[model samples]
Target: MLRIHFAGEDIGRVRIAAGPVPAWEMLLSLHALRGPADHGVFGPWRARTLGVLDASARLLLRLAPPRGYSPDFLTPTADNDIDSLVDAVQSTARRRLRTDLGLLAAQRGPAVWMRPLADGDTTALRCVGTAMFRYHQRVLAPAWDRIHAVVMAERAARVADLLDGGVERMLSRLHPHIRWEAPVLSVTYPVRKELHLGGRGLLLVPSYFCWARPIALRDSGLDPVLVYPANRGLQRLVEPPDTSNGDSLAQLLGATRAAVLQEIGGAEGVTGTDLVRRLRISPASASEHATVLRRAGFIVSHRTANTVWHMPTPLGRAVLERDSGVRAGHGCQRSPARAGFTP
Candidate 1:
């Protein structure tokens, strides 16, 4: 952790002194550390701006989900394939991928700058480069290099690195007011066990479960050209996996109680005349749905005359698969009139 944080002064022995860190803390902290430090430096607003830019860059990638070879790490493999025929075909695959991404970088350079700012204000540009290097050379590059003579995996990394590299180079070209937290803070989050490399995994849940949507995205097995260019590497933080500690769905939102939570477009306090106008449902329909979700413990409802407001519970967040934005069809709930609501 320290070595990664400093990016200097190798402290491999430090691990002996620290002992093994619990998987959870190690993973979450590493993940958090990857976040652009500008947020930590310029305060929340600048940090948020950094986050927004990062999202925009990522969104540009996701708007066009990698539509090639299934990025499915879980794909089933054949038990027996003769190695004799494998060598020639593998070599071909590598060159093809590299060429595709190289072409992409050349064509869409501006849309995909590696880093956000000109100055190397943040370490993500560097760290991500390293991570990409490792995941490629060690993980996929070797296999592809042998199978595809041109080393498709390595080329893909090179192309992505080159394009994003331009962004980093630009950062170096002009210095910006960069920020850093020399000694990092311990921001605890509930994470899976494997993330903890050291045994000191802390058990703490953040008060607010929902944060600005996680930017992770995975290629959904729908593309092929990406396989040729190691650029298949760009991973957008998409929807997170469900939490085990979170409340159960049925317990939170009863079977036939109120409206479905996933369908609620936006009914926070019913203050939005626009929502009323848009939904076009009588005040009764709207209020009833809010009431059901409230009763199911998915939301908290309060009545101020004709206006009723609803806020979600942590349980609702898990079911909605999000705590922040409820894009289109999220957090829907409806109570059967037979079940009853005063509205």
Candidate 2:
């Protein structure tokens, strides 16, 4: 028997025989696919999905107070202490979420499908995938929960903050596009143990891949399990093959090619005219660069509603690394050009 309690806004440690998925996992999933699906639902899918995810994330942050975060924390790719980096990343992401409730609520409800604020025709899952890859590096890796008690001391008020403006407009706007009545047992409690699914039981814990996906434990019946992001051991493998050894690599990924990578990841991912808006380049320019990168094994540009989106290759991250501060080769030696690139 499991005992659950919500004191005011506090969720006492929820101890399940099987653990709940990490909050980050759910965020990543929704973010990964904030684009339209094959059904071609047009604008509504991305908007509604994001609204759902944004809603879910707010709920989770409330439960998992930010802990052990420090100001001077370094990025995971940096040589600074690993633990501090993690704390910083987690803390920063939480802070960003806290302040961005307005953006979340801005695009609410099921009717949002008729005209989603997202403006994309790309599949939401692909968008979420690339976004997660970046999110893990840019946010998750650096967030080590060493001092959770401090950063997230105040209970996150996502619901109160967004829900305050009157539910009538919000839900009514979304009512036409979404189905809230469905059994949505959002599996996002941060402190759960032992998850039983279907006829199986599984263990959940933190690890290199612990912050991956939040499965519907009850519906999927797969028991509780930790999921690793898909990039896994593949991130480094994607580097542009160091073709700098020859012009071969550059022959493939040029400045134009790199820009495509930036565009796709810019506002996470966009489609239709939104893609043009995000890339900030003309349709021809976007198409040409995308074509080149796709040929060179650097990007996967997809089109819908007359717009294009790019998904970076593992090599894409490396290509961006010269600017990213991720020490790949030459053993972290700081070049005078890199100012802070100390050994």
Candidate 3:
């Protein structure tokens, strides 16, 4: 188990990443590609990425092991910008690169590439950075629109949790494997370890492809970061239902309410403003319809940062499926516009 000792200041300092870090996602996605059997959700993506990677890009696989230890410099922070992250990796301090690469080599056994890296070769380091950038463009850039939307929705949910019950509640519910016990947050890790925050606090990052368990930085001396799996519902965002039986449901619920339900059903965790924009209706109309749907138990809405996010309940999905005679997972294609959303 990994025990995280938190100071008082750390409580207020706790933060959620606004979106996925491109480099981090690339690293984890590469790890996922190594063992497709372990992560079924990413099966399609793994196949697609495998078909594109070249020998040079494949070299980056050495930087991340399927289990345990990845160089810290590869993933700078929670920043969503890929160029900035690539810049950080390329400009990493020679000593930091040597130390992190040495540790990675030690854990996974030395690779031929490590010789140049350990010698503080800038060209070798830039090669690794180039590989990471190429991998990101090939594997993650295409899906970034869907990825960003899901991540933003996740952030909205966590922000709601923070608002509802403060930091403790949010921390406790971060993942099934994590436990918050006031001053210390314990994580069931593959290896036994303890991290003392010493009031620097922790940055919680939600990753769409982080797999089953939460991951933390191996060297506690660096700023603390915890990358956890995003919600299961996020998987649906990857292949959003194109069309729903909204016409039939619209008859039962008014046209507007049915349209709202269809949109909520198509994508879970959609905000009222999102609905307003999609439906081309006023905010008040969207909120009113959503409230009625919530009262009828078709959907549930949670308010976070003054914005309300709506998601269909099982019954709501059932109602739409039954009414439309269109089963879940079968729908129209997603609009190009729906593919991206600002977080």
By lDDT, the best candidate is 3
Better of 2 and 3 by TM-score: 3
Compose the digit string of candidate 3's lDDT tens values, residues 258-327. Answer: 8999999888668888999999999989977876665555665644436567777666776776656433
C-alpha local distance difference test of each model: 0.29, 0.33, 0.75
Please give the distance, in angstroms, between residue 114's alpha carbon in candidate 1 and its true position after superposition: 64
TM-score of each: 0.19, 0.26, 0.73
Name the weakest run of 10 consecutive residues (lDDT summed) in model 1.
224-233
Candidate structures ordered by TM-score, highest first:
3, 2, 1
* lDDT sort, best first: 3, 2, 1
Worst 10 residues of 2 by lDDT: 149-158
TM-score of structure candidate 2: 0.26
Residue-pair clashes per candidate: 56, 39, 2
Cα misplacement distance, residue 317 of candidate 2 (Å):
2.7
Q: Give the TM-score (vs. native) of candidate 3.
A: 0.73
Cα displacement (Å) at residue 114, model 3: 0.9
Compare candidates 1 and 2 on TM-score and give the better one. Answer: 2
Task: Give a tens-digit lDDT track for model 1, residues 1-343.
Answer: 1111222221121111011111111122223333555433213322333343332234223212232211121111111122211222122233333443344444455334422312232343333233333332332332221222112222222223336644233212111111123322112222211121132211111101012211111222212101111111121122123454243334434432223354442332233243345556566655555544544445443222243334444445444544332333355543353124321
- Model 1 off-target regions past 4 Å? 1-275, 304-306, 322-343
Candidate 2, position 206, lDDT? 20
lDDT of 1 at 313: 45
